[model samples]
Target: MEECCRLGLAKSIGVSNYSCAKLSTLLQNATILPAVNRVELNVAWQQQKLIEFCKDKGIHVCAFSPLGAYGFHWGTNAVMDSPILKDIATAKDKTVAQVALRWVREQGAFPIVRSLNKERMRQNLQIFDWELTDEEVRRIRQIPQQRACTWKEVVSPDGQYKSLEELWDGEI
Candidate 1:
C-alpha cells in the first residue's frame, strides 16, 4: 500500500477481494482512503451493505461480471436463472443481459462488463441509453444473496477466515 502511494503510479489504490477487516487495517495504516474497491457484484450477488459501507467511506465500489457469465457452467446458478430478470427483460423488450447491466448502473456503481461478440458488446453499452424504473431496481436488489466466486480452496486452512462470511465480517 505504501509503495502505491510512493510511486504515484495509481492516483488512488484499493483492493479487490479484500475482507472488511483487511480494509479496516489498510485504512488504519494509510493516509488516504481507496478510490475504488472492485468486487464480483451483480443482480443475483448484490453486495448491497458492503457497497453502502464503501460509499460511506468515499470509496467507489466497482462491479465486475455485470452480466452473469453464462460461459462458465460451474459458476452458473439458480439466481442467474431468475425469472424476475427475464420478466424485466421482456417488459423492456431488451435482452436479459441488458437488463442485468442496467440494474448495476442504476445502483450507482461502475459495472465492468465484457463480451467478445459484437452484438453483445453493443447491447451492453446500450444500458446508458436506457434506464430501469426505481421499482425495477428495488426488485432486482431483492434477489437472494449468493456468491458466484469463492476463494475457499485458495485460503490456507490455518487462515483466520474459514469462509467468506468470516472474511466479510459475517455480513454473509
Candidate 2:
C-alpha cells in the first residue's frame, strides 16, 4: 500500500472497524499512518477515547451507522427511540436523527448517514444549521450505550476473534 501511494496509484489509505488498540498496533509497524478510521459511532455509542486518539494521531474519524442501523437485524433502535434524544429534539425543534448526527459532528468525526428516501436524506443534512448546547452534550454523553452490531452471529469459529471482546479488542 505504501508503494502504491508512492507510485500515486492510490492516493491514501483508510481502515474500518479499527479500534484504538488495533490502530496502535498497526501504527507501530506501518510505514504511513492511516488517513481515516471508520467505525460505528453515534450519540448513544460515542467512542470518545478512540476519537481523541485518532485526532491526536492526525487520522480523521468517520462514523458509520450514526443512526444506529435501526431496522437491520444486527442493529438497534437505541438512537432513534431514545427518550433523551426525543426530548432534545422537541426542545430544539429538530428530529431525533438530526440531533444524533449533529452530536456526531460536534464530536469532530464525519458521520455517515444512509437513507433511501429523499426527504429523509434531506433532513439528515439539516443538522449543520444548529448546535447542541453544553448541557445538551453533557446529557447526551450519559445515554446508555449498547453495541448494536455485535458481529456475534457472523464470526467464524476458526476466526481470529472467538468472542465480541476479542473482536473489538475490548474496546466495546
Candidate 3:
C-alpha cells in the first residue's frame, strides 16, 4: 500500500493501532513511509510517546475516539467526564467534546469524531475556528493518563500477542 501510494496508484497509505516497535520495524524495510497512523487518542488515554514517534517519522497521527468513546462496550467516558476538561470548556464557552478535540488538534493530530445529530455534528466541526490557550494545554497535559481502549481479547497465550504488554509494546 505504501509503495502503491508513492507510485500514485493511491492517494495515501496509513496504519491503525500500530505501536512504536511495529512502526520501527516497518520503517526499517519500507520503501515509502506511511502517511498516517489512526489510533484511539483522547485526554484520558493520550498516546504521547506514539504521537512523538509518529511526528518524528513524518507520519500524521489521526485520532480516533478523541472524546474517549463514551457509551461503547469497550470504552469509558473518562475524557468527557473529566473535571479539568469541563472547567476548560466552561471557561472557553465550548462543549467538552469540542475542548477535547481542540487539544488533539493543537498536538498536530487530526481528530476523527462522530455525531449522529445534525446540531451535534455542527458543534464538533467548530473546533477549527478557535484554539486552546497555552495554560489550558498545560492543564490538560496534567490530567491523569490511562489507556481506555486496550484490546485485551486479542492478547492470549496462544495468540500472536502473547500478552497485553506485547500487544502495545509496553505502551500501556
Candidate 4:
C-alpha cells in the first residue's frame, strides 16, 4: 500500500492498531514511510512513547477513540468520567468530551470523534476554539494511566498475540 501510494495509485497509506515495535519494523524496511497511524488513544490510554516515536518519524498519530468509547465492551469512560477532567471542564466551561478532545490536540495528534446527535456533534467541533491551560495539562498528565482498549479476545495463551505484553510489545 505504501508503494501504491508512492506510485500515485492512492493518495496516502497508513496503518491501524500497530504497536511501536510493529511500526519500528515497518519503518526499518519501507521505502515510503507511513503517513498516519490510527490508534485507540485517549487521556487514560495515552500512548506517549508511541506518540513521540511517530512524531519523530513524521507519522501523524490519529486517535480513533479520543472520547474513550465508553459503550464498547473493551472501552471505558475513564477519560470522560475522571474527576480531574470533570474539574477541568467545569473550570473551562467545556464538556468532558471537549476537554478530552482538546487534550489530544494539545498532544499534537488529531482526534476522531463520533456523535449522532446534532448538539453533541457541535460540541465535539467546539474543541478547536479553546486550549487547555498548562496547569490543566499537568493535572491531566498526572491521572493514573491505564490502557482501556486492550484487544483481549486476541490475546490468549493460544491466540496470535499470546499475551497482553506481547500484543503491546510491553508498552502496556
Candidate 5:
C-alpha cells in the first residue's frame, strides 16, 4: 500500500464489507483516510455504529442495497405483509417502498437502492420533499437487525470469523 502511495499508482484507497477491527488496522497503517467503504446498509441492516464512526472521521460510507431488497426470501414478512409501513405511507402519502428508501436517505450517507421497475425508479426519488421524525427514525432503527444476505462461502466453517457476529466485530 505504501509502495502504491509512494508511486502515486492509486488515486485513493478504500474497502468493502470490512469490520471496525479491520478498518482500525487499515487506519493504523494508512497515511490517508480511505475515500469510501462500501457496505450493506438499508432499513433492514443499518450498521449505525460504523456509520457514526466513519462520519466522525470523515470517511465516506456508501450504502449497498439500501431498499432492504424486496422479493428476497429471507426478508421479514412484515417487509411484505405488514400494514404498518403502509399506514406510515398513508400519513406521508407515499409508497411503502418510498418510506424504506427515504429512511436511508435521511441518514447522512449515500444509499445505492436498485429496482427494475420504472415506477419504482420515480418513487424512490421522491424522498426530498418529506422526512421522518426522530420517533420514526427510532422505529425504523428498531426493525430487527437482520442481514438480508449473508455469504457463508466467504469463511471456513470452523474459522474464528465463522458467524456474522464475529465478522461484524460484535457490533451487530
Candidate 6:
C-alpha cells in the first residue's frame, strides 16, 4: 500500500476493522498514514476511544453497519429497534434509520449504509438535514455497548487472534 501510494497508483490507503492498538503499530511503521479506517460502528457499538485516536491522527473513521446491519444475516434489530432511537425518531418525525444515520454523522464519521432499495437509499441521505439533541445523544451514550458482528469464522485458536478480545485488541 505504501508503494502504491508512492507510485501514485492509489491516492490513499485505508484499513478495515483495525483497532487503535493495531493502528498505533501501523502508524509507527507506515511511511504513508492510512486515509481512513473502516469499522463496524453504530449507536450501540460505539467505539469512542478508537474514534478519538483516529481523530487525533487525522484518519477518517468510516462507519460500517451504521444502521446496525439490521435485517441482514450478521445483523440484529438492536439498533433499529432501540427504544431510545425509536423515541427520538418519533419526536423528530423521522424514521429510526434516519436517526441512527444522523447520529453516526454527528459523531464526525462517514456512514456507509448498504441498501438496494431506491427509496431507502434516498431516505438514508436525509440524515444530514437534521441533528440529534444533546439529551438524545446522552441517552444513546448510555445504551449498552456490544459488538454485533462476532466474526466467529475468522477468529480461531490456530489463527492470529484466539478470541474476540485479541481480535479487537481488547477494544471489544
TM-score of each: 0.87, 0.95, 0.94, 0.94, 0.83, 0.97
Question: Whose TM-score is higher: candidate 3's or candidate 6's?
Answer: 6
Winner on TM-score between 1 and 2 is: 2
Q: What is the alpha-carbon lDDT of model 6 when measured against the actual structure?
A: 0.91
- Which numbered prediction scores highest in lDDT against the true structure? 6
The models' CA-based lDDT, in order, is 0.76, 0.90, 0.90, 0.89, 0.74, 0.91
lDDT of 5 at 75: 42
Position 159, candidate 2: lDDT? 82
How close to the true structure is residue 45 of candidate 1, measured as C-alpha lDDT?
A: 80
* Candidates by lDDT, descending order: 6, 2, 3, 4, 1, 5
Give the per-residue lDDT of model 3 (tens digit) for 1-172. 8767768999977899999999999999988888999999889878888999999999999999899999998887889999999999999899999999989998889999888899989998899888988898889989998888899989888889998899999999
- Candidate 6 or 2, higher TM-score: 6
- Model 6: per-residue Cα lDDT over 14-129, one tens digit each: 99989999999999999888999999999989999999999999999999999898888998788998999999999999999999999989889999988889999999888876
Q: What is the C-alpha local distance difference test score of candidate 4?
A: 0.89
Candidate 2 clashing pairs, residues 3+ apart or interchain: none
Count of backbone clashes for each model? 0, 0, 0, 0, 0, 0
Q: State model 1's lDDT.
A: 0.76
**What would the per-residue lDDT of candidate 2 be over residues 1-172, giving only the tens digit for each residue?**
8889989999999999899999999999999889999999987689999999999999999999999999998788999999999999999999999999999999999998888899999999898889999999999998998778777874666987787888888977
What is the overall TM-score of model 4 with all chains considered together?
0.94
TM-score of 5: 0.83
Q: After superposition, how far is residue 115 of candidate 6 from its true place, in Å?
A: 1.4
